[model samples]
Target: MLIIEGLTRRYGDRIAVDDVCLEVPRGSFVGVIGRSGAGKSTLLRMVNRLADPSAGRILWEGRDVTALQGRALRDWRARCAMVFQQFNLSGRLDVLTNVLVGRLNAVPAHRSLLRLWSAEDRAIALSALERFDIGELAAQRAEHLSGGQQQRVAIARALVQEPDIILADEPIASLDPRNTRVVMDALARINREFGITVLCNLHALDIARAYCDRLVGLSAGRLVFDGPPEALDAAAARELYGLEADEAVDHAPALPGPTPQVAPFALHA
Candidate 1:
């Protein structure tokens, strides 16, 4: 379980997070949505310790994560995984090698940087690929794979790390419709099968309603709304989206892709 209390972050005189408090239980999926610069990514980064909160405490399981250092910090980090919007893979390396690098946190730094993975590491990497159903692309270089394939490889890498929760920062923002569904489906399956908690920042309400169990909305660095997707009606959407809603939806095409597996949902665990 993850517990955040009075979470806050500020840049000089500007406040990015304003005493927001939340709890994520084990094996739950939550989505965050808002216009640009909503501090959604900032909130996730704080949980992973990528960005420190100026004032607050993040409790993982039962320990105060903010107080951890050295080995403790490293171990805490290993349990939280991050997936980037730009698929941050080493394009020069083969897909298999890229996923194998996920084990780096547990390996010696020198060995990890040199890419001298052990035989056991190789097995772990292969197993992750199989889990994602992308083992066939093992030998292919990262740049050679399609966007969907690259994202899948990234997921496999995260899986190999044995993370408890996945923090995706606008993961599908750059993908085409087809690839978008592929990547989103992969995330959904991981959440269902492996019970990996998911905290995703998304731009589309439709996607949030489809895949996420809960929705947290931010506007101008403040928490404006938090509830189930179905509860966020057109009126509430207008408040969050502002006067641009009509123009935005008018331009949105029905993106072609596999319809996501909607299920009985609950607040973030």
Candidate 2:
């Protein structure tokens, strides 16, 4: 389980995330949803330790993730891989080499710097690509693949890390609707097959409801709502987006799914 206690982040006078507390059960898929500047990205970044939290305690299996440093911090990062919206791959490098970078923390510094990857690591990288149905592109440079393919490659790289959880920060924001479904399906498959925890920041409400086991709604840095998709009613929707009833209706797309029986959670401070 992952526990986020009083998690907060500030920039000058502005608070990016405010005294938010959330508990994520192991192997669950949680989608963080809000407007563009609602601090969704900052929240995920702090969870991955890519950004510092002003005041908070991130505990994973009783260990304090917030206090880890040096080799310990590097190990924590390796255990919690990040996938970005921009597909952070080396454009000049071949797909296989980019995927092999995930093993850098496990290998000696000299081996990584010299690109002397082990045969075992090469097999692992190739297997990850094959899992995502892109093994044929292993020799192609990352720059040449289409956007959807590139995102899949990014997913493959994250998979090779053997992470306990994936922090996907607006991972599908740059893709078209068709590609969005493809990428979301890939994430779902990973969570289902590998039992890896997934915390994703998403903009589209329908997509969140369709894929996530639970939805976490943030409004201007505050925890506004937490619940199963069915429990997110019209009032909660309005609060999340700061919208009137009419606008809220328009914003929530009609998607078909069974209404989960779980109840909605109370708002946080």
Candidate 3:
């Protein structure tokens, strides 16, 4: 289990994430929802130590992640992989090579810097690409692929990390509806089939409700709600978004219920 206790982050005098606490069970799919500056990204980054906490503790299993340093911290980060809003791929590199980068944690530093990957490593990278049905694009430059495909490549790269937990920070924020579905489906598949724990930060309530087993709502850097999607009624939506439920819906596009299908636009609300 992943335990967060009184987690807090502050910059100057402004608090970004305020005394937040949560428990994420093994193999569960969780969605963190909030407005753009509501500290969703800050909270997720703290999990992998991308952003350091000002106070409190983050414990995975029983070890305090906040206290780890050097090689220990490196190992912690590898075990807890992260996916970003902008697909963090090397545009000049081929898809396969980019995916192979995930193996850097396991390979010797000199070998990785030289781009010398073993045959077994190459095979593993190919398998990860195939998992996302992009094996044919292995030889193509990452920049040449479509946005959805690039995002899938990002996921494939994360898979090669062999992480126990995946923290996706607004991974679908930049995608069109169709691409969003594709990425979400891949994440769901990874969670269900591989039993990897996933904590995704999302903007759309519809997408969160459809895909996540549990929903966590944050507003102004403080958690406001935590429950199943079905429990997020109109009143809760209003509370979470700081707008009337109907107003929130009016600002957001109607999204299809959770399924392996695609639409055309993204819903920011």
Candidate 4:
């Protein structure tokens, strides 16, 4: 379980996250929803210590992560995996090699700097690639894959970390309808089969309501709501996002910017 208390983050005069407190239980699929600056990304980054919290305690499996450092910090971070919308893969490296990068906690950082991953690690990465439906692209450069395939590669890399919790920051920001279903279903399957906790940042209410077990709504850096998907009704979303009842009418998911595409998935319990 992940417990957060009094969490706060600030950048100069701007408060990014404000006194947030919440618990994310194991095997739960939770989605953080808000507009551009609602601090959804900041919260997930803070959870993995990629970004420091100005003040607060992040407890992972009963251990306080606020005070961890050096080997301890590394160990704690190893138990958590992060996925980004951009995939964050080495464009020049093969997909299998990119996945193996997750094992950096076990490998010497210096060796990683030299791009050396063990044969055993490569095999494990291949297995993950197969599971994510991109095993054929294992030897291909990351930049060579399509957007959907690239996200699959990213998921494979996260799986390589063997983490109990996965934090996905706008993971489906650039996928088509088919790929969105593929990726979200993969996450759901992992949660159901392996009991891994998934905390994701989603822009579409339809997507969150369709896949997530619970929804967390943030407004202006403060959490406005945290409950099951059913709790975030059309009216509640309008308040959280400053959208009119009609404006929230047809939210679509697509690459950020330009005309936002309507979400393809039908929302249901």
Candidate 5:
């Protein structure tokens, strides 16, 4: 379980996130919805320790996450992987090398700097790529792949980390409708198949409502609503997005509910 207590982030006199508290049960798929600058990114960053909270306590499975330092902090980060909106792949690197970067936590600094990846690690990276249907592109440069393909590579990289929790900060914000479905489906499949807890920040109401088991709404910096997707009625959406009744929700047809069936990749001994 993940426990967040009195989480807050301040910039000079302005508060970005205000004393928000939440407890996330393990293996739950949660989507964070809010307008621009509503602190969705900040909240996820604090959980990942990419950003420090001015005041708060973050606990994971009874351990004080906020107090970890040096190697311990690095270990925590490795366990709590993050997927960013912009696919942060090295354009010059091949897809396999990019995915192999996830194993840096276990690689010695000298070996990592020399790009001396072990055969077992290479097998694991290829397995991840195959899981995402991008195994054929393993040797291709990351810059040559389309946005959707790159994002898949990013997900593959995160998977190789073997994280317990995935904090996705608007992962599909830049993709088109088709790729959006593909990416969201992959995330859902990860949660369903591996039981990894997902905390995704999303802007599209339709996507969030369709894929997430629970919806968390924030406005201005405070959490305004937290419940199942059906419980988030028009009124709550309006207040969350500060939109007119008709404009509050995205009325687009919902994405297909079934998780995508990509073949699982098994590691070679």
Candidate 6:
């Protein structure tokens, strides 16, 4: 189980994530939903240790993730891989090489710097690509793939990490409706077939409801609701998004426009 206790992040006086607490069970698919500045992304970044919390603790199993540093922190990150909104792949690199980057922590620095991957490592990376139905694209440049395919390559790369948890931060925000469904379905498959814990930050309530086993609603950085998707009624939606019941329909897109300004550390993904 992953336990978050009184987790908080602040930018001088403003609290981006305030006193949030929750427990995530193993092999569960969780969706973290909110408006642009509601701290959904901040919370996930903290979990992955990409951003440090101003206060509180994140406990995975029995260890405090907030306190890890150096090699320990690197190992922790390897176990908890992140999938970003931008699909963070080396566009110039071939698909196979991009996927193989996930093994950086396990491979020796010298070998990785020289791009010398072992046959087993190459096979593993190829298998991950095949799992996502993109093995044929392994020889192509990552930049040449379509948005849906690039996102799938990103997922394949995450799978190569053999992570216990995958933190997807607004992964579908930039994709079209069709690609959105494809990416979301891939995440669902990973969670269900591989039993990897998934914590996805999403803007669409309909997608969250359809894909996540549990929903966590954040409003102005405070966790307002935690329950099964069926329990996120109109009233709960209103409380979470500050919207009228009619505007809180499952298909309603997140409020469009510039996201509210957050701390610089929290903006990178």
**How many clashing residue pairs appear in each of the predictions shown?**
2, 0, 0, 3, 0, 0
User: Sort by lDDT, best first: what order?
Assistant: 5, 3, 6, 2, 4, 1
Tens digit of per-residue lDDT, candidate 1, span 1-269: 88989989999998887888888889888988887787888888888898999998999888999998888888777788888888899999999999987888878989987888999888778877766677888999999998888888988787777888899889988888777777787788778877999889988888777778899888776788889878988887777779754532322333334534433222122
Q: What is the C-alpha RMSD of each candidate to the true structure, in Å?
A: 4.9, 7.2, 6.0, 7.3, 2.1, 8.5
- Index of the highest-lDDT prediction: 5
Highest-scoring model, TM-score:
5
lDDT for each of the candidates? 0.81, 0.85, 0.87, 0.82, 0.88, 0.87
Candidate 3 C-alpha lDDT tens digits along 26-105: 99999998777889999999999999999889999999999999999999888899999899999999999999998899
- What are the per-residue Cα lDDT tens digits for candidate 6 across 75-100? 99988999999999999999999999
TM-score of each: 0.88, 0.91, 0.92, 0.88, 0.94, 0.91
Q: After superposition, how far is residue 221 of candidate 2 from its true place, in Å?
A: 0.5
Q: Can you tell me which runs of candidate 4 are displaced by over 4 Å?
A: 108-116, 244-269
TM accuracy, model 3: 0.92
In model 2, state the lDDT of residue 81: 92
Worst 10 residues of 6 by lDDT: 260-269
Q: Decide which is better by lDDT, 4 or 5.
A: 5
- lDDT of each residue in 48-164, candidate 5, tens digit only: 999899998999999999998999999899889999899999999999999999989978989989999999888889988888889999999999999999999999998888888
Off by over 4 Å in 1: 246-269
- Native-to-model Cα distance after best TM-score fit, residue 265 in candidate 3, in Å: 32
Query: Which lDDT tens digits does candidate 4 get at residues 105-149?
Result: 878889888878888677777877777667888889998889889
